[model samples]
Target: MTDPQVEPAPTRALPLVIAPPRGRQKPPRHLADLSAEERAAAAAELGEPAFRVKQVAHHYFGRLERDPANMTDLPAKNRDAIASALLPKLLDPVRTMEADQGTTRKTLWRLFDGALVESVLMRYPERATICVSSQAGCAMACPFCATGQGGLQRNMSTAEIIDQVVDGASAMANGLVPGGPGRLSNVVFMGMGEPMANYKAVIGAIRRMVAPAPDGLGMSARNITLSTVGLVPRIKQLTDEGIPVTLAVSLHAPDDELRDELVPINTHFKVAETVEAAWEYAKKSKRRVSIEYAMMRDINDQAWRADLLGDVLNAYGDWNWVHVNLIPLNPTDSGPMLNGQVFTRSRSDDMREFVRRLEAKGISTTIRDTRGDEINAACGQLAATE
Candidate 1:
């Protein structure tokens, strides 16, 4: 009798191509997003125990990348297969750049596909935060940000996005980061792309973030913030997701004229309309909406514009529903090589006084301490260097 031959089981391969029209073809669904039952079904497909799905999740979530071998929990063969299905190829750190007294570290990761996306790990005395990228490159052409300047290459798979967090969490848990073994308490989708544009996967990553370990990563929703440059309808959509993450709107200007230029999307959805939608989201989410104002010199940085900003926000019915994050313009590579940002032209302190005008009117305000400027890691600055 001739020896019988067996074929190798199929594995997942992400199609690397220019993403087709978003509606024409569905983006490749990742196994990370599936429910427990679905994960069991996937485990069963690999000729492994359905229960091993939970064990694999424990490897990723409960232990925070504690080696499956270290689990001492699952049978050898099953642990290997389970780890392969979920983590697959992990992101190895290619470069680590730090600034702000080692409190902020921006890691450039090479995915299995070799696509370069950056994530930032920032430390505050009370909390450690991770800023994650939702897409590889951004399509939003915000002239000030390097990532936006690169243009959109592709959206990250859910696993690809979530893994950045898992990797960061693991790094923190293992004392690999500056402060040893501190918990990662905050997640921000403000690093690379317009997160709301990659709606589905971002939502999936959020669900995975808050779910209890073994079933999910178990991070709190309050510690996570999903930022967007005023994508009106999507802001409306997030209200239904029922997660109470604070929403940060990148409203770079108070009026349509400058905003139309600074934030191009303003041309499509006017400032008034955007804030109204933000208001709806605030009411539904029952959380304060964050308005991100990028201060540029002699460009939307006028005292009149400040007063107008306060008035416009006041028109939203109550100033208490909104707060503004004033990001002083970080220098970009376009100006000079080493000292890239042209801060000589603008003083952010002047803008701080403008924010004071809003605070004078009974509105809440916070001047975000600038971090990671030395590494070209500030918001929108990543794609610039890439």
Candidate 2:
């Protein structure tokens, strides 16, 4: 059963910790960051009735209304004051690019402080999905990502993160997009930063996305996915949150040697530890953890590597709940470096062979469709570049 011609896989040793950037920048306060009681108290302090808080919440969350003038149910004179006191403009669209017959639109947003973050909305026959950024840029120095090249700017506030979704929903509601009026059915936190790194705001955004009308967008929790580059402690903490949103682990390699180089953070928490954390999340949430593997040329695309990966995942013994999503690395704006290159797209034959090897071992696998490639909207391509 052994392929003697192929070289043996290298031994994966636990790597030493590579310290991450210290001192995170805090974002400004917004209404979405407040709890329900706090919102009511704020309204009361503003001389508006306590019931007005729920009314305004309905306008923003349930109705997807952004303009204060459009809330005709409120007093015309008091509408602006109430909205100004509670809701503040967060994201201003700088540029929006459309591709794939205009079904995929990517927006470059300028925050209040002029920091840029990007979000993409794609429409399908039955569903429309919006990819929202949790931070202005990324702290994870994944060599293949354009976002990581610039380093982290700061973590986005709860309202800033939720505004991306509200904007997409508003676009769909007003028929601004090509595919007629439709609701946003899915939200994925895979745009610019690692969701797990911005734990508080990201969790708050999830709660708002899942809570019913007037309190949240009322989207189903199951439709939202939070991806991380394997932050072990946060992965365990998320299990107790009880939201049950799908957790996607960006595990590019099964072995630690290559992973430590590609995902520098891996040096801190090795491959086995990361996988175990993911399994714990799966057990608590009862949601299958998606293993995201980006295929590159001869680097990590060998058939033998696929077998090794399968063996690693099989070690967890929950073969039924874990799925492998193979992503063909998108060519980033950043060129190849001695450490690694973002432009190294894997060959088709090698990718197929890798998938075949995994399937042969009884592990479920799928190749992700690289949507919005023309507009640089694929995975790891959100660098806020024009």
Candidate 3:
């Protein structure tokens, strides 16, 4: 088959190397970064009317439809063309595993490029949430995470990220779908890649998600979250964007020495500075910042460390904005602490007692619920070793 023509992606001119590696790596390109104008141009070239671009946008971004047969607004002649133009089969279900009484679903998508990525659709009585990935393989080598162990294959484009949510949203709305028809209430970038690593595409995808129907995906800005392993500079950048979405900092440890090995980037910006920066975002955005701390047994979970965490947070008590999600570590095949995260001694009893200490210190705290444990739900785990 002749190579199909598609719109050329905008060039960053800045090369894709995060750290100058010994060898070459391909420049990252994912389809989510394109603006509506670019998508319209692409559609026009495919003989789709310029207006149908809006319809396609409505379907993918607004209506969140994948099946062309369901796109009733277009002429039957154009449905196939429009569908082929924008919603090219980015991900087809390789498999879906459900647990938590069918309320939680984990889907492994085989991308058109043959890359695999995972998204989770979890349901609660109040709202359903979709945890989506912006990259196929993560560049960050956070040891505890299954995805990090694999190293970075590449960043997923904007469409790749948005598609995961759109599909989930559609499933909820269509009722004929997998997780049942209900609008998605939350979208989180706590998946595979360091979202900041795929910065532009990730931001573009966010705009698409929150933009109104016929313009973008039409989900509320408040329902989105972009978690990072404390990328200090990007955290500042996200604050400047003023999107009002939640900012989650994966600060696995409150101290730098461990984070340097656990999160790596923290070596450049230590825990204190990262928390300060997060305070800045919270102050400006007026939204609470979430500190994602994965509690490893005998690791960072000690009562003293938790007390120190409270001390650090208390330093910035002015913002009225911060919470800790102490995630209990999920054991992996690698030796413990190879990820350089999860302290060597969490003293579960002490750690649980410590949350009381932090709260006594007036720091907001909660232990996060673990999901998708049965089906290797950890990011990059399924794609790893494949």
Name the lDDT value of residue 203 in candidate 3. Answer: 91
Model 2, span 60-128: residue lDDT tens: 998999789998988998999888777888988887888878888888888887778888888888888
Number of the top-ranking candidate, with lDDT as the measure: 2
Residues 1-386, candidate 1, lDDT per residue (tens digit)? 00000001112122222232353333333456677778878877878777677777777787876465676677776666666665576466778887777777788876665567888888778888898988877676665555665577678877778888987888778777776788888998887778988898899999999999877789999889899988888999998889999898988788898787666788789999999998888888889988877666666678888888888888876537998877666644334121232322247677777778878877777666676656767543443445
State the displacement of the C-alpha of residue 29, model 1, in Å, after optimal TM-score superposition: 7.2
Return the top candidate by TM-score. Answer: 2
Ranking by TM-score: 2, 1, 3
The lDDT of each candidate is 0.72, 0.79, 0.71
Error of 3 at 11 (Å): 36
- TM-score for each model: 0.87, 0.91, 0.87
lDDT for each residue of candidate 3 in 127-155, tens digit (9 for 90 to 100):
87888887776666665566665566667
Candidate 3 C-alpha error for residue 55, in Å = 2.0
Which of candidates 1 and 2 reaches a greater TM-score? 2
> In model 1, what is the error at residue 113, expressed in angstroms?
2.4
Q: Which structure is stronger by TM-score: 2 or 3?
A: 2
